[model samples]
Target: MSATPAGSAGAGDGVYRTGYFETRLAADPNRAVVWRHICDYLRRWIPADSDVLELGAGWCDFANAVAARSVTAMDLDATVLKAAHAGVTAIVGDCTDLSRFGDGSFDCVLASNLLEHLERADAERLLHEARRVLRPGGRLLLIQPNFRLNPKEYFDDYTHVAIYTDRSLTDLLTSLGWHVEHTFARFLPLTMKSRGSRLSFLVPWYLRSPIKPLAGQMLVVASNPAR
Candidate 1:
């Protein structure tokens, strides 16, 4: 990864500061599978002509996949942003504050595996900023880790700050005055008891039509409420 102009956030605090995509020296197969699933979802929902603002865009892989007209991939790490591809304008910035851009600056805002690293208040504030930057009826796509999933598996990453549940997150969005259009769980849960079971299929099924109130990683699609 190369370097870019630094922003407000400092480098290397070793807390919520680490970028998982940048630190992974080698690719983990299961993680790759999850990334592919995310790409597929983005391709399906995000139109080619839309302008996207991706928060915590570690390496810009999602930007590469989505054929959006314009993508502003923002991250705190200058080195990570430097490695981002041609289509993405890598900006070294913080997601919690969108003062750099005016209101309704983007058609779509994406935050994947980002909420866990933020404190609850910060996460809420970030959502508010997302709402502030989004155009009327614009979409906010959030992909967060599921607490029900094996913590040793997903939460083992040094950067993961907290766990999230489906109900609480959806309520969080609703509290922020955004109308959640869709909520589904993605990523195969790593379980110690049964490694080979077909339970992974059930995860998505439950998310699409949930029986329980929780999941592994809740993908929430909330729209800016009509003013």
Candidate 2:
């Protein structure tokens, strides 16, 4: 719906861009239940009072539900302003470029179902900026769809431009100067529409176990080496 800077996902003139977002909006009512479970799972990595910055924060679902000292939810979609909760400071911007914020501005940088949407160059720039803006001991939490596992439906969405697996993602972050702290090869189901999404009660049990069934996503948590 909006013209963002070049090299960004879901912002350019894509055919599905118009109604695609609207579709997500329609599912928000039911998705809120899933968001709550996601927020709870996120708390294990995010400490209280830690400033959090969520990139490509579509609908601000996780941002709104997360508990932190401060939360900034940004996206290229203009809808973020309306979809974001009042508690969240929502802004519209290019995910690969974070020039508006100063260096060392946050304790955690979060991206959920976002990185696969960018080109490698753009994603690298985003990691660079994320590193530049995080304080010492900061963490970058990425919840990405694992193409290795969900190859069949990975490219179903027209916006996906990059593919990453747990190993590849770890290598990418390590080469980018961040230390891989933890990586879960299988974390959550691939799509929000999956049947597991409705069973929020099972989320806690699943995250604590090593064996994740029907898992289609990868959770990678990396931190600055400075700490």
Q: Which ten residues in a row have the lowest lDDT in candidate 1?
A: 1-10
Best by lDDT: 2
Q: Can you give the TM-score per candidate against the true fold?
A: 0.75, 0.90
- Please identify model 1 stretches exceeding 4 Å from their true place: 1-9, 12-37, 151-154, 186-215
lDDT (tens digit, per residue) of candidate 2 on 62-181: 888889999999887766788788779998778778889998999999998887877688789899999999998899999998988889999876667789999999999999999899
Clash count for candidate 2 is 0
| Cα lDDT of model 1 by residue, 46-143, tens digit | 77788999887765656655668898888766544565678688887667878898998888999877887777777887888889999998899887
Q: Which candidate is the best by TM-score?
A: 2
Record all residue pairs in model 1 with backbone atoms less than 3 Å apart, i.e. clashing. Answer: 146-216
List candidate 2 stretches off by more than 4 Å: 1-17, 23-26
